[model samples]
Target: MFLRTPPLTAALLSLALLYSASAATHAKENAIASAKESIASSEKDSTASSAKKSIASDSYTYANLHDVRVSHVYLDLTVDFANNALTGFADLTLDWQQQDADTILLDTRDLTIKQVYARRVDGQWRKVSFELAERHAVLGSKLTIKPGFQTQTLRIHYQSQPQASGLQWLTKEQTASKNQPFMFSQNQAIHARSWIPIQDSPAVRLTYSARIQTDKDVLAVMSAPTEPGTARTGDYRFTMPHAIPPYLLAIAVGDLEFKAMSAQTGVYAEPYILEAAAKEFASTQQMIDVTEPLYGDYRWGRYDLLILPPSFPFGGMENPVLSFITPTVIAGDGSLVNLIAHELAHSWSGNLVTNATWQDLWLNEGFTSYVENRIMEQVFGVDRAIMEQALSVQDLKQELQSIDADDSRLFLDLKGRDPDDAFSGVPYTKGQLFLMFLEKRFGREVFDPFVKKYFDDHSFKSITTAEFERYLAANLLDQHPGKVSSEEVNEWIHGRGLPASSPNPQSDAFLRVQQHSNAWLSGLSTLSELPTTAWTVHEWLFFLNNLPLNITPTQLQQLDQAFNLTHSSNSEIAHAWYLLALKTGYRQVLPALEQYLISIGRRKLILPLYRQLASTPEGLAFARKVYQQARPGYHPLAQGSVDEMLKAD
Candidate 1:
């Protein structure tokens, strides 16, 4: 279940080409270790997979300078909308290594390799088979066994309209973002293959240089920053000076008009978000304030973010640069800055120190969540931070009580989980809440510095569950003597569902609310009716969220009387009341609820409710059809839990 990997050597990555003797020795050792690990692990993995569908017969590994070292890659892509096809022209460098290594395979998905352009050290032109391509292409025509050569430099041409994966033509998912042109790539889950061809795995990290050509007005950015003099003719080029997993290789293109500002730390956001994104990013500065002091200096250059359309399923994807977030957070009201901060923290925990495989995803989720709270505590105050943590734990507990509580386990998989599950209660929130518990267990002064050490040592390398646990036990043993972790938490990583340790505040609150509501609702029977002023907004919301099993018609009338204020108030609670009133067929009071929905002002909530109402047998079909027709294209939010809403009963 685990891939064997050597411990990552201390960074032999020196910015200056000139190195001290010690540093040079370190670099050489690191390179040799990387090469040996690749060769050994590949061979071992081959032996292990020999009993399965094996690719070793034709597939092999060359030295990958992408991890632990700085290597540059450049590619030009020609994408055809008509055919849904792609062609890539790449110029990449292989660091100093010389041998009879001929089979150079790139991570390609059903791409056809045409021809390769390169100069052999022998100074002779020869045709090589760039052949043996089956679902993937090796990048050369001939196996030039040139020894004493330290690096390999070559250009390759690949063509294929790969299946929609990372870089997709998502015309369908773009409508929720105000019908603006939008696209997103969650490359972290190993979907980079559906887009570009390279070593498609996360283990082999690399520095990327890309020039993406698209229609004019198609703004561009990558997980990395754009290099100067590297862009041309709508070709958005980027240079990843830092080594990053291919999963973090992201690109978002839409008719984006973003303005930029430098926070001195790094450019915070592009200007396109002024109305919506800018407002959403209002609290983003707090994320910077809380995280920087704790995690040491920022690992990557400057942090930048982009707000995607509303259909974006996750709160945001931490794509090194330009973190793509859910468009819905742009409420223009700063109520949901916690989500903004959560994704921002991933820049350090998930982006910097990556989990080699999905199994060890807590290295990504748990750490990021913990850091999010740290950031929150700094900006929002410790009390608010603690309260938020309590609420998150409460949410996690409710999730654990679901018949499909195992679904909570999907949070850390980072693979095979639903797009909607990214901001899932378990992985992001509960995970953070767990970290909060750990913080209390250790206390801040001790826990805070340990977090910095955890990330700093593991940056740029892939880690597994075992490695994390070992570090946790070892690190904590050193600091919090006698501190021990049981199998309950760590063992939870391998399976689905929580570790039995997940909180359950919802059930507790449910019991209490059920009691209060039962008593309050029954007491209303003592009176003929409730005056409009009797039902407060907070009470109404609490009642709706904690609605009892079933209320008699008399009780419903009592409630209606309670909410029959002279003026129709417009608020979330008021909307709930109106919906309940309409549902109960309180013909006399339903008009106010209808008006309440109209007045909520969130343009996005209208169509769904209309469709649901129409679906009801007693509701007008024509009205439902009209609302359904207005529901436009592929916004994920627009498609959200429609069935769930319909099945609420």
Candidate 2:
């Protein structure tokens, strides 16, 4: 309706409409500003994600390899035993991938950095600033150095702490000679950062050279071949021309003597252990000789063995040219030299072509293990190889019972965890089995060439599991479509538990041993009636491992009396026997077990005993007591493992 309003009322209505229009304009402006903020946030997130993807895929390292990488390293160092430290200056040659990068990153643990200097192409060293980030429990610290974009080289002056996780310093009493102190480095599975300021990931490979000054009384050895006829003048120089992951960087200083097993192979040990170690590992040359035709030629110049003291943690560490071996494996006879074969196999599988990250550890270990069995079969016999394979399968099955489903897969996901945790039977044995499955299907006639090609193609390169999977598909699986399916291969690598097609490694020797073990357990035969005179170490291990869990203490005593198991010189057999004793509450072996624990620090042989003991209250007390005494001598790796186990209890 059209009606005339009073002048005051009309003026008020017009003012109200103007106020509403102003409020609407302010609300529209606010909405537009909020939309702009949201768009900016999304763009920022996208940029961050792209930058993260540009970084290397290795989860265990803090290195910015996308911007800069180490091409080569030169170390000048003094081994100061008085302070139990390594005083060194590392000269790192950088490969600047991004020309704009003004800084470089390194990994370190328990290191005292003194100074950092950078050099440009003009060759003038200039001091640079650096920062050491807060230390992490497992990953250690991130070292960032602002060397500037013009820098070509970085020299870091540093000293390792006495209690560095990578270096183990031993008093004279702890060594075999008992006359000279010993020091060795165990740098595998991310321990290299504990001693050296490096890009310590397996993905980073670099050639290295070193000059080490030691006490005039001792000898120095590294993972490189020894200089011919070099005098022992307290100065040692080493050069590894072939690129290797930092973990393979190893060193030892001790009262060591060398004995030649062959022109290209030898053994280094204390004076007392020299002759026996040489004799025990005399077949190392044969192992190398046999491995070449089946796999590839050994590219490393010389393959030598270093017999570390009893406190060496693992059975053997495959340190390129010189493999560090535990004294426990020198079982008087050569039965344990299979460990040598395993390490030598690493020349091709691990050292030549390494797993890019710890997640693909199976690529190194599994392939090496499979090649080890083949080498053993060539040097020893098929029976020995079969027996070892069967034992490995059994060990894998038992390990699977305790490991998580994801961890049991051939391709491990070890993000946010120590690579050492991946060092289990899953990678070593299960990985071998997966390869063996393919070998069984394709036959060695066809598979051997593929394996040899795989090594040759990837030589001196670090590779990821996905890259291997693709290579396998194109080179093997797709090439022979009907034999093995890609789905099956994926299941073996990614699925939980063993596949139905997994190989069942059978051994006639083990069967005989099992039959004898069963007869004794069933009370149908006496322990003496079993044919034990000609039994090998593998047979003995099978016999001990297959014994019933409900076996009586009296039966154990009788067996010990018959075989002298308490005094068994074979470490593997002794370990198995001690495990049985603990299970049955047989206290007679306690003293010997304690002595064994104290003397030999090989984790494979002793950790099982400690774990079995910690399962009971009394056993836990005993384990704690023995560990307290033994902990002083163990490598930091072994110490941490046992500590975590006992802490859990």
Candidate 3:
């Protein structure tokens, strides 16, 4: 079954904005959607009145999951590099929680369902009756199947559409080798349904194994354990013993090779860059060692990293055993290895203990952020950790100024909206600072055990924010109410705006950078006189970000000539310089700025630059031109956001 949507016109988008202006309009629309959903849910509940059922996860998935419990999945797929798609079958093993339940609903998007079969109590598979529900713009379709009473497994044969949002196919020109094609999957925040027929919710976790067939010369890796010394025979097999949410099921197929940094930690890149990437990430095992003491053990057996080509969207995606990271973070000086720590921490907080739903996202991000700094402090130094925290605090304050006040809360009500829109520095930084506040009040010696205990109690389980709050109160607050109260904790978790008790993050290194920025603005120093010889990427960013918004082109020229930031190899520094160039209209750096925008496809670096350039007609035309060439290499997540902005008036 297939569903099609007409492309949106500028006039229609304007009309949409007008219609959305009224708060009542938003409320009424939500009420209508909710009522429709309630009627559907009511039917499912009515079918199994006596059997226990799980609450429906607050997600866009149409799965009637309350009556079924998925245990394992077997995926057999052929990776078609020429056509840029995955044609496969998924065999799922599940149990019916309610004896009378007779139907199964799975989530899918941009997928063509060819056939479905079920195994009966007689141990024979037979074709099953299935229906494709109506599709919403973002929610996709629900594949409902009527499996008879004694069925224990279902098999779905489907092929991903060319426009599958989770998959990105890159031509040879997009890679460093410039000779082989590449493809990868980005499935976070519910895009898994675009490529895989499964229950696409974090609230659902299951084990999976894969058999991937690709081109003879290409290598395929997944978020599961692979055999060492495997030959390139166009077929690869992987298995995961630990269960994970659908978003954690990832795959990459390309001209790639693996280099082991340790027995359990390694790096994957194209053959030409394998050694360099291995060297760059030599500290991965050390990070794991440091992280295990903070939380419990690293439950995931191996912590490997796949350094994808430049067009990968995010800084890092914490896939269970294999982390997909952008090449931009390989700054060659070991300055950006803290991102490794962050992803490694996710092995505990996000992979092992997941948020029950997207609304409790801070339960994953905030806890991971706090643990990331702890690992960085122990592996690196306290000063480096402080610098990272200070930068996060700076970013949080800036984010709070621009976003809705409701979005600033750690616990969010992201109903009737795309969960990806809630992603920002708010959850990471604010959650970390709130935990820091508790540590300050109760003291580290008292609170350290609680941190480890929380992870231990909830390992391998999805939890809501309320459950975490109850855990916090039962373990720490109830015993020592005089130190901190539940009301204060609520202010940080549910209330908007930063809490009064949030920690003040200070960095001595940034203090010096601020002084130089102040002196330059006060006319007491020339651009060449600033002491930046020992500055790191963070210091350079602070100096550039703090410059006055109304600075002249002459001042920018003097600074750019002195520092040569326009040609810097560091992606973070180059991104900062490009943004400043846009604000100042420093025409001299336009060529380098354009190169930066096209060469790096990381959404963190490019999205803001594109938005800033789209503010003026000439710049907008230039952005559109560069994007036309860059769009083929960009991931669908990045393409979706940039396409909307460029298409707008």
Backbone clashes for every candidate come to: 21, 0, 0
Model 2, span 19-61: residue lDDT tens: 2233435344234223322322233221111122233388888
Q: What are the lDDT scores of the predictions, listed in order?
A: 0.52, 0.84, 0.80
lDDT of 3 by residue, 320-439 (tens): 889998889888888888888889999888888888788888988998899999988998898889988988898789879989999999988886788787688878889899999999
Residue-wise C-alpha lDDT for candidate 1, range 1-649, written one tens digit per residue: 1112222211212211122223435345334334323432333222111122211111122223232121334566754544555567654444422244434545554456666654344433233445423442222112122222333445566665534445444452333334334455656454565555555544555665565666664566678754322332455555555667667878776655544433522222224454556654666655775677888666565556676654454556788866776544554445456666777888788877876655455568877877876787788676555555655665466557753644566324433443334444566665565565566567878887888898888766666666776787778645576543655445445556555554433333334434567666767434333232444333334456556436566776665565453133333444455455446555565444354333322322344345436556655543344334333332324334432343333
Candidate 1 lowest-lDDT run of ten = 49-58
Compute the lDDT of residue 70 as modeled in candidate 2. 72
Query: Pairs clashing in candidate 3?
Result: none
| Candidate 1 structure lDDT | 0.52
Name the runs in model 3 displaced over 4 angstroms: 1-56
